[model samples]
Target: MSSVELREGLVVVAKGIVCVVTKFTSLDNISVISQKEGKRFIVPFDEIEFFPAVTDEGVALIAPELDELARNASDDEITLAESRFDVIGRYSCGEISLAEALVTLEMSRSNFYRLKKNYSEEIGMLSLLRYNRGNSKGALKLTDVVERYIQESIDEVYSGSSASISKVWSDVEAKCISSGNPLPSMTAVRKRIKMRDEKELYKKKHGADAASQKHDARPGKKIFSRPLERVQMDHTLVDVILVDNVRRQPLGRPWLTVIIDQYTRVILGYYLSLHSPSAVSVSSAIYHAALPKFSFLQKLGVDVERYPYYGVPEIIHMDNAKEFRSKKFESACIRNKIKPEWRPIGKKHYGGHVERLIGTFMTGKVHFLPGTTFSNVVKRRGHNSDKASALTFKEFTKWFVKEVCIYHGRKHSELGCSPGSKWAEYFGAGGDAPMHPPIVSNPFKFKLDFMPEVTRSVSPQGIEFKKCFYWDAALRLHVGKAAVMIKYDPFSLGTIWAYLDGEYLPVHFSDVTKSDFSLEEYHAQKMQGRGEGHTPAGGLEDRSLAEYVHENKELVKRSQSETRRARKAEAARSEYLSSQREESNEIDVPVDKTDKADRPNYSRRATPFKGKNYD
Candidate 1:
């Protein structure tokens, strides 16, 4: 009847009922079995309406125009789809166990099975792309009145009490009846309670410390056989206190975020700052890990010949810090083919490699610094870290790099060779035939992809960040538009990249003559209430921010501690920007002073919410 081909195992509708095509008895007739009943029958091909297949397991199915639709999807959507496809691909290749796949994908057993089946049967990437935007089947379907009633009852009845589920459900039902709302079943009440976080539930029922004790466990270590296969990331406050760059006064201890290759025990990358660890620190470390480090070392003036460690890791193991759990970091990892694996709640041993490496560094080398605080209070009691502070932030950074080089060359007890030797054994010209993992081709674009992003409206005047306006001739057409996604280098405040249409257009300070300044310096000046040069047009006055900082000697002397800390942070920012500039020739991202011609003519992957209004 229809020109569409009919073959065995193909799903189609026959006589208003869903069925699987068994065979074409002849050109004029086809045999089919009812999907629900398994009853076989032959029907005339002409009599069949040739129903278009549209549903799968009660979910609406999309047509197979996948390629065009996929290309049209936002960058985030495409990245997420590819990530799901990668999980399924790994499972199919037998590279990861099904259990590991389930954990990595963060999918339930049944959900993962359905995804695998759909991926295997149809367009893999398309199937992984979620077309449904509503709640899945079996989700709680209670009205607001019932939900509120249950919540109130739970707060009044079960919280801080050893009440059983049945008791709580009975109380919730009674409350629902009294509230004049439809009563939910015991199963629904249990499911609602189960939907809550286990830690929250435990804390509400028992206590906060009890919940922590329950979740904290020391599990065995995980071993990997290849470099970059399972990298571990963690952050710690440096044991030693440091001084400022200019004044060399005692500053507070800085935070350090480190990433290490578990297989080779080699340090991949690190970020240091006076501020505590945040999403920015984690992102910078990841960006650093994926970039070629030869230029970075040369710029630092470190004498190390090779630190050949850079790639999109297969799995990044991390603790349950909020920074590691940020949607931005997770999205970046998935986009780059990295599987983020959190250490099981309470399983400290899972991150042993990086932990031990940090410990060795701090105890073995850092404790010898002039302002060392040592490891514990007992050891640090007489140190007076602030009074004994000696090294400036720059000096400390150079010394840290030298220590890292030294650490890489020493023999490891477990491997019976140095980390550098192990790295070369696997990736060098000989050894076990080198394994070349994916290298980050465009380091600058890679950094932008992982950098912090914020949404702001484009005013006729320009885009404002930290009370500073950035504008460009190209942004004039985009004025009056809202939710222009922007990415900025924290180290440099004079320029920012605005996502317009599809590409990141670099916008500079409205006053192009002003010198670039670090965010830390700006905040420090603002906090001191010294550099408030306001113009009549609700803008900053035309003055050199650098000059203002230089003239504020009294303020710096009055707030020595805070100024020293700020200077240390600014120094870190300066070094970071320096490394970035050194590697700019390897990528297409334009530097400050946008000439349009020098800018990279590339479009970022579109995000799914491209059309949504930020207002």
Candidate 2:
């Protein structure tokens, strides 16, 4: 259920008419004004259907720290808080009408509404506590001008090692004298400096690394007992070199993005590509993680009947990488009810789980592969990772899938049993606390929700994106109209999905015969000045694209360039080459088509992390 409280300023559908709540008459009765008709009337709470909030798309607003705010409240403050809670409770529960509750509390209607608003928005009872007795203890009481001068001095003069507290005090005293204000005592200046956050102060005084070493020490272990309760996601460049599909020449290492469930220590999902990790990588990994893997494994030619670990994680713990911090990534998480958490700026230990998992894969499995970089220069002294390379990307992907399955079965040092066994304890048939994990019903739509979104206006010819033109018959109706949203897959740019009306309408390239290629290949072409000309209004022909690929392949075979760009280009072209035969004309959405009879009828379980004791 959504956490938004039905209160004033919330928009809802009341008896099929869109209305905005004007005021709350009582728990059952809300006075609302119709958005269309501008008519004010009382709407029964049951008849109103709430949707996403006006802002933040449906993300629940996090309330303030109520316990800390109410801790130092006085006796009178406590009494008023209790009374306010009583009145709001009575009004909301319908035990007493709005008028009776208001009169009993001896408050005006406006104040009553205000109190209720505070209580609702503040996440219940403690919000009613009054904390405005006076300036808080230990808080600075310097005059505004004096305080500003002191802060400016500290920031400008004392932030460096050359300036001391005495120097800052002297600067502040000079400013006060010039402004005809009372000079602050040295003790006050010292107190202000002392109150500054240690890490930030150290960073300003020295540098980021010093501050990080002084602070951000490892904390206690993060314990999670349920699968998908807290997942850690991270990216690493795989240690082994990969070869191209066509010429078998060595390509560079590919970046692997892995998502691991913290409690079970099982690999939930991963995405591998030659391009560095970006928003696409993060989104693709998340899409793979939140949906079942049966069809995914089959596509990779792994014959696994059951890979029961798939669901939206309650919290995704990730490092403060640019990809994880992108607006598109955060918006997607919020839209899907997934929370994205960033570890402290300099704290590497916060991401230990995913980091250690990557280390284990590199040391235990990848180190033995042909053309392995062996993790560091010291380890790779006598080895030739490029000459020894043999595995192609497709073969490596298959190996990765099999390795993940094997890893799941291996007994974990901390769990005292295999991760697969731990997963089965909660979700397997006839096991302790057997429960069904949440699944995305429409996997295609779920994946689409995370694809990077773009908005463009329709033109007479079609929509142009990244120097390519896409058109569909459905776009004719809205040609040259208001801009509409579209999403494209980085792996394949043959078709882009246009969000028109309500559904996603597939928009194909203007040149219908052109084959699909990745975004990396497109950029590579542009970088070589081969993508300079205006694409024919009809779109670049398949013949030209094929010629470019042929040239790139010849270049790779002759030069065997180990540069990142050449490797990325080969990786992109190889994906197209390997999948040309198997690529489905229809979208590969992996929608669940399992027979109801074959699917297990496991009982649904509420998220286990909720209300769990943290202490």
Candidate 3:
């Protein structure tokens, strides 16, 4: 047999069968174990064909079949070739004589002694597979001239230069000849470059952002142990144009804020509005999520048999949007005992649940509606969305409610059941459902508790806020006193709650006639008048009661039209409040009746009294 170079543990094809080399025998024969048959055979080294080098794609193409065989192979069969070391170890410990062990194992004495000599030299399995195992080699073959040339070429490539491999090779050859050194082959240079990791190469060619997005490790899907363990909330602009209720003219697109339960993949609550997202939108969605939704469905005319979801989640996952990270949002979460978890910056996929929900709703349902934008500019080509708009804001809201109900009943891809059904399974059906956290007893009080707060002094003209005066019978006793903390809802300037004594007292606009407008609408109207150079003059505190009366006279006609709308809204509010009271068994307490004549006042004031400056 020809003297072929071979080593132990080197994988090769022997007689057309895939096998790994085991050992060398005294007669210069080689032992190899077949991967598929798990059998050992001794043959000449010339019978083995070493594995050929292939590209990554070629390796992947044949990986499955090889992987299956490797997975199914028994552990003992795979490690059986290493057993000879165990025998050698035992004999060295005086367990048996070398001759006796060799005889029992049916091996020649020369082969046994050679194996012992290789083991004693501390050669590892991989070292044994190498061609020149343990041979002393000279220092690295690359001359200093070639090393400097290669380094400079790599630095140039990494500096955003568009130098090709051939160009680098040409430059390196030129530098080598000038220094009187033998020119290196292009193949050697290419091999060195391929050793660098993909991330580093991408960073050199593109940028850090591209490299991070391509190579950063991401977390896998999280499994929540129970319902309401974590909830994700986000906002997206709906992909459909809306029309005005009265004029039937196309308004701009509206925004939708959705909150989803991570465990059940159910939509806990959502809010839709023509205005952009803000702290108010987030608060509205969270408040609705914490309360039972049967009343809301009835108001929307949805005839769903049951809506089971309602909870104060343990944790709320959110992106780093300004509205979500604001102090008001943080304070609300802290007060409700809910943990706020902000996803890492630049990693929006952490809140993938809500993001996916938005995409699905917009692409699947909204795209089919009139005046749909079709999600992207490419899909929306040649479509006149604004002109095609036919549904008014009110109509769109009703349609949206119906769609949500349908979605609740539809089966989810991963959950294998409807969101509503899953919710029922987690918390039982009908009367046996697991007890959830109780809904807020008073809806008005609940809104006040979560609203943003501001401090205002009680002047003789009543509590002044945003250039408007709010007063109640309770404010008479607080006038000329220190400043008191008051909380107001941005959505409704109709009423505010002042923290006085030890309780929150409901305060209404002194001129009940102007109480129908929202803070947003009030500002909008003022801005409209200011555009025509009719801005209100004088400081808020400097205006006289007569001037205020005159201003009220000028707005009387607009207020009359507002009054009719307010009445309709008031009826709806009454119905909602009645439902909340019945469900929670709570009663509204009168502010005046909450006081006791014999009780001593222990409430802290903003400023100390003249006779008693209590700290």
Candidate 4:
């Protein structure tokens, strides 16, 4: 072989297999790591017939000698002779010395002399390359028996058997001995299996999903030009234990919905709830993302310079999660002129940025908390996360917000700058200022667009929804209208927006006090009261009255619990609304009570009975 062909890391053919040259042992011998079999072999220079040459553009150039030989010889002849003549021809023409050519070419001195004499006499180089087709030479070849044994072993392994290569080889040996047939070595069997492509092997063994994820990996890194141009949204079950707001008892884990800016690696918005991810979670996350964070921070009682990230992204990239793929979420994105891009099903790596962020947050921040699960089962084996829990929902929220702020200010490896600095660099510069999506003119209107909608008809009593009555003076105008669309927040069922003639009229619960209860709590109470026997008015049965009273008491308890929750939520909302109104330069519109007084009183009032007397 030429010196160029002996370079380390160059690929060359040895023994009918491709190997990479690791180092030269001598002028005649080189150490090579076989790419095909993954073993080290020290072979003579004459055994190397081809080596790869790559161009500047990364195109592989085929060996000229191999191409020339192919034109003059059959492919089977090349395979049988293993291209040894091409190496011999180079040495015979003074390309290299004879001592450097005779090390380990797998030929005896007599055979070499015979080949050299044949080359000198009758057939020339072609004669030197020819192999006697009938010469078996007592070498062991894989017979039909051995091949069948190998196929059986592979099938057993693919069938979920715990059989290792050694075990399979033992079985093959036992079968061959019993049948009085020769058995192939384990190395040969392993090589045959390795020659099969990984994708096909994994698919047969583990199934298609595993095969795709393991063997058919995807490209890394999604590029974006500016902040908020595109974002990734996903939900994760938080790894730290959280307690109920009022009871201060462990509530297992909370679910967090996060919106991440792809360009700057900034966490744009997040929502934490005890409930699982749903359309409500998606809406809340987007609503938070599209508004200033000042109000939210104020409501959380967190004092920061600013929580700068707030905008509607041009495109939101998410996995094909049920919540993300919901019609309500898609409709909201459309209504706001944003595009929703759902990654292909089972391709979780497409949303890798947010997934990595969740990992980083859980590892760096959450694991240090008192009630951390420590990510996986092994790490959490001895730790009772529930018992160690000390943080209430509010406390956790505060800590989470602070950690997010710290993350924004900390340097990111990918960005080479803090997320906050990147945001400032783009948004602060006037000429190339980051393009912010249009500000929401009215929070109520913006939220309504995203809130879940239901169709109902207005009646003389009111619009009945979720087993409750909602009323508005404007609803009277459309009392008989069928298919009136009502949009409401599941978090706070205190108010709803009724869509009529392209306008959404605000509606409140008919009994003002009942509006304080969320739909979930109301439903719970209704279920608890269902099927209870009613007591007779004239003659009350003690058992029936006791059951009725017990049901009513449960209802009252639920009502009180719901009222407390509503009060807290309302306070936060009030603070947020006040801040929003101030920021938007809008004044609160006062309702005209004169119209309320002039409207006919539909509410029932009791009149005193003048003539009724007890005997």
Candidate 5:
């Protein structure tokens, strides 16, 4: 029972299960303590342990087992196990977790896990464990040799070919012999080491090594000019298995749509929904981004709107999913003066920002949460099958627009700051960074346009558009002669609504009779399997729209030549009429007022969030 501490100028020498050294009170008080005792002694740091008085009620955590562990451990064994005790106590006391210590020590987790579960040596700690290197762990034991060999073999198998196992084992053996260390047989090695540990080690080492090589880490490029010129769009699946509380049933898998400014890494717009990343979803995402709620940031002195990219993306980079390239999607981007930048087929690294975001959200955070979650409303709906357990299309949309996105805008985990802050920093508003001057004007204009149109049908029951329908007695009046506008989803004919003049007629498309097929449907039914049909997820392989159009220019030009001639004739007629009217006005005569009278203004509506919400 040696109660001792190391004295100045005296090193503890550890022999086979024994030690010899002078123990004293302190570095400066060493002479006094030794003079009083009048004897030299040896004990490891582990043998020198203490607990505050039981009656003292000190703030230091009272580990009931600690005092017993100290009292039980012999003097000689403490020297060798000093490192072990220190790590355990510091870990048990929560001064620092075992993980932090292990990472600091750069040791394998398996060793520490075993030590944590089984070892009970009392070594004085963080102060010592940090300074003392565990170099004298001694020559490899039989199990240690076997484990090392197995890990090396597994590493070999993963690094290259599995059939090279024999060569790998021979290589390790030759190295061990060269280094004068005992080596294990291939069979002993393979049987002793667990495959899971090998796989984990291999993954950790290889992953870190690969990432180090991959992250060349050049400074990121500064974004300049047209707002959405480069939007990094990605599809992330959130998996909380959201369920309708009332029905206790599944909702659906929620898809997260993020429109990030590639140059700035600003999240221009974002949305979450039980729907796929459709055109509507993309539009909704951009719309919210185009009009973000920045009042909080404004109060924080961030003027986001004045920032370079307050709204509108010029180029949206997306994967080659069908949803990204469908006519509806292309039309939206074209109408909004945005070019859809498609990643090369199957090449993801180029679009890593948004792609990685998906992994970060689903597997990393959402699903990794400790308990159950109703995160994937869409997938849940498929599982639950209860309508009530589902989110109304409108409600899901608002939540995404208002909450999910707002949260992303403020959360700083991913982007250096909240995504919205990046906008200000990049644009030279809030940040002290120098701004890249803006381009005078975007060379690209809207290559396409959207004509607000609808799908309609006059029926005894009702008409539908995009899976919804409408029916009203007023619609009956317009059934034959009136222009009954079917407020429809040009994307899906299943839903529709009847509109007459500028008024919505009462009727939901879902309420329409579902008995018969329309003429388009009849044709589609007859022509089943004749073609690939409307579309699929895959895009038209490896080519951009401009390239596609360029390749077909001759044929398309010839086809549109007739339409071009008609348009030219109308322009010439209008020019002639204008010239005559101008001449008559010069002669002081009143000109015909037909032009003004013929095109009377109809009902008009104000655009919501007009212009852009920049800051």
Candidate 6:
């Protein structure tokens, strides 16, 4: 090898980014970056734009077409990757960052940077052109849509923002409108809006449904039956984070759900989430609670299979919510072999046990950050934020063991004595060693994703959904194909890949695939069509229930169902009106026969406790 001493001169431009090529013994790759605290990127020789000019010291590099890269490269693609690499390199190689190297090489960071970036990324340049061209034609609306899509990609970066998707969309529209821009077509605008709305709806619906699923997962419907017989769980939303150091403003309350022994209230499991009260986090808390308490479980008369809840609760209680009634929830209960017992709607007494515990958090030591609503109060109380920084979810769990099993171990202040002593005294939980061992998470392992049978049908072209068929062009080869299994990534809400006959295709839905945009609306229209005729198309001859029953049993049954449905519809309308009335007394509430039927139920629940009888 020739005698060539390598000096870090003006880091030369390679590809479109700034890079430095060391002329020392055969170097294979070069890392380039920007100096800004949060803005940096790296590109190998192939990716970076390099200048033909080479200084005596080494090759000089500049971030050519920096604007294009800034526009097209994702924050993670550039900023995060660069920062992470630099940090890692500092630890491992102690290599100076690209910006620093540039400073030392060319004596001017910006000047050397300009030289390296002689070439622009054509792809990024094209994207810029695409965005700018839309300016004359509802471009801002399109920009708003793109922004939303991009925002989701980096949502974690702005997780603190309270701006909802709808709010953001509205803000975009207003800003454009204020500038006298013509709005995008309403249909197109709605197409843009529905994407996020669908996920939100799905998330809410699933969360509600998951609660019952948790019940189904209980080792027993009632934990007291014969040791680990059942577990009862409920989530509480609380206000916390008195001072959000990140935002320098108050944060919304956190939600925490605990899965406890329906029999022991032993605090078997719990989870705290930044989101509001939800089933997903509730399940997580329960999962964390369940997996670890196993060794202690055998002591309580439980095993692995026997662990999932069995024998339904004798009297389970919760405020009426969709989570309690969802089909999935019911199925979970059925699967776990437990009968679900739901508290009467709005009945506070029925839920008093769980409610009172939650209440303690509200008035007890749990601190409520300002702006905390009643919902927030409950969350802050259950969150176990005192140990929020625990390295692992399981470690944070130690806080519950300390709080519920330790500090509160005394003569049930609430239990009348300490839970441990109370357990020995009342439930007869004495002398039995915990069944399995205290459950611990396998830090080396992660949860296997839940795999559910997604009801689907396949044909020549692709899969069919809601009476519509969708198959990407690449899949056309497999048209009239057999059933294909698709796994979805929850975080991205996108298809991870598809499997056809056990072969992974890595295929995702493409633009050509028509989405179920009007699924809910179409179903509503179908239901409306079914509701058109009751007595008769033109005559009242069948109006009498007896006549209808005699002529057509089906008609009679349908009429009865229609009657019930009509009553429900009327009640819902009345309830909505009543809510509006509360907001503004001048608004007249709707009159409904169902309201009369419902008022009694509400009044009964709200009735000052007359002792606790459903009847």
Highest lDDT against the true fold, candidate = 2
Q: What count of clashes does model 2 give?
A: 0
**Off by more than 4 A, model 6:** 1-231, 242-249, 293-317, 368-408, 423-615
Pairs clashing within candidate 4 = none
TM-score, each model?
Answer: 0.48, 0.48, 0.53, 0.57, 0.37, 0.30
**Ordered list by lDDT, greatest first:** 2, 1, 4, 3, 5, 6
lDDT, residue 433, model 6: 48
Spell out the clash pairs found in candidate 2.
none
Please report, as a residue range, the 10-residue window in candidate 5 with the lowest summed lDDT. Answer: 442-451
Once superposed on the true structure, which residue ranges of model 1 sit more than 4 Å away at CA? 1-221, 435-437, 457-462, 466-469, 480-482, 491-495, 509-615
Model 2, 429: alpha-carbon shift in Å? Answer: 4.5
Q: Which residue ranges in model 2 land beyond 4 Å of their true spot?
A: 1-219, 429-432, 455-471, 478-484, 490-495, 508-615
lDDT of 4 by residue, 1-615 (tens): 223434776656688665677898987899987653468989998877554444557454544544344334554554444445655676678886665556535666676667666443222233444543663343446898788887787766543324356766777788789889887888877766776677777777677666677877576676677888899999999999865544456656778999999888888988887667888778878887887778568767877465867887899998877888888678878988889998887677788789999999999899999889988899999899989988866578788898999999999998899998888878766785645545777867677777778899999988988878889887767888898888987556778888887888888889976636444344334433332343334655665577887899999999999999999999999999999989866766776678776876868686777996778
Locate the minimum summed-lDDT window of 10 residues in model 2.
525-534
The window of 10 residues in a row where model 1 has the poorest summed lDDT is 525-534
Off by over 4 Å in 5: 1-227, 286-310, 359-416, 424-456, 460-462, 465-615
> What are the Cα lDDT values of the candidates?
0.76, 0.79, 0.73, 0.74, 0.51, 0.44
- List RMSD in Å for every model shown: 36.0, 38.5, 29.0, 25.5, 31.9, 35.5
Q: Kindly list the per-residue Cα lDDT of model 3 for residues 1-615, writing each as its tens digit.
A: 223246666666788665778888857678888875778998786776654323445432223333243434454544443456566777889999978789765789887777666553222221112122452233346777787787677666544536466766777777788888888788767755666687887777776656777888876777886788999999999999876544556666878889999988888887776678987778878877877777567756876465557788889998888989998778778877789999887776788789888999998999999999888899999999989988866578789877887888999997899888888776754575665545667766556656767899999888988778998988889888776998886556778889999998889889977845445445444443444333366725444667877888979978998998999999999999999889765666556654586666678456655795568
TM-score, structure 5 vs. true: 0.37
